[model samples]
Target: MAEHKTNAMRLLDKAGIRYRVWNYDPGDGNIHGTAVAAKIGKPPETVFKTLVAHQGASLFVYVIPVGSELDLKQAAKAAGAKKIEMLPVKDLLKHTGYIRGGCSPVGMKKLYPTYIDDSAMKLETILVSAGKIGLQVELEPASLAAQVSAKYAPLAKRGAGEAASN
Candidate 1:
């Protein structure tokens, strides 16, 4: 497995990209989700989570705000793959070397197509998982995509009650 400072963190620092590291209470592991949004004092829509998926034989990732779920159909369409689905835990581990709770969009074992949900673009700064539980880093969506070589795309929509921007 990767070390404490994951390839993600190293990439950020190497690029001299500015980001703030936030630590929060990960209560029984589930807290990395909504609890992280609250801990950072940001709306759930401004705090994003990293999800790994597959497009044909290739791996893809979606970085979306916590308020929404991964729309697999949208993701597949964006990737131009006939089908797309969540990568199994074993595949996720093999691909990113990070457990499900601490996946980061910045660094991975290989370069996967990265989709940053539209919701994140609404915020001047967004929080993303920092390759470990209880750790997060804040940066602009554009910077994350550029520094990480991500392919910007919309992979999710705001949950039923929220507005359309997400």
Candidate 2:
């Protein structure tokens, strides 16, 4: 079966960026980032998820490892906001033009300030949602960051009971 192109893919194509699409089975009903990473055969740390947050009138996008969670305080500091709150799931599509489990930092309805976890710098490439559930785009982290005009910052909070190794 031919793969369907998403807005994120089209945007990358137009910019002459190269990427590999990994399609996984979503029939299992598990669309969580870590599970998707396992299905795609990539380490959880290499598969990132896009999260959207807002502070009053401003919206921000964050890309962090699937195995980790976004630390709101760190995110606010990274984005220079007084405080950041996760954008309600109901309001996701209205603000980002993408739904949960498929939001890509790239090719959003608007290019909000984006921040990628600096941990991505340790990997040669990273995978992120391809604007659709069950699909991911793998590309160089720097390339992805440049495409989205994103800055690299410390934004991930390790899972509960996980120690900081760095």
Q: Which candidate is the best by lDDT?
A: 2
Candidate 1: count of backbone clashes, pairs at least 3 residues apart or interchain: 0
Which portions of model 2 show Cα errors greater than 4 Å?
A: 28-30, 159-165
lDDT of each: 0.79, 0.91
TM-score, every prediction: 0.88, 0.93
CA shift of 5, model 2, Å = 0.7
In candidate 1, residue 84 scores what lDDT? 86
lDDT of 2 by residue, 1-166 (tens): 2267999999999999999999998875447999999898999999999999999989999999998889999999999999999999999999888989989998899999999998998899999999988889999999999999999988999666765444
Ten-residue stretch with the least lDDT total in model 2: 157-166
Cα distance off (Å), candidate 2, residue 75: 0.4
The alpha-carbon RMSD values of the candidates against the true structure, listed in the order shown, are 3.0, 1.9
Tens digits of per-residue lDDT, candidate 1, 1-166, equal: 1236656778998998888887776878867577788876878877889998886578888888786788888888877788888899877878887888889888788778777776666679888989888888888888998876667567776556865543
Superposed Cα RMSD, model 1: 3.0
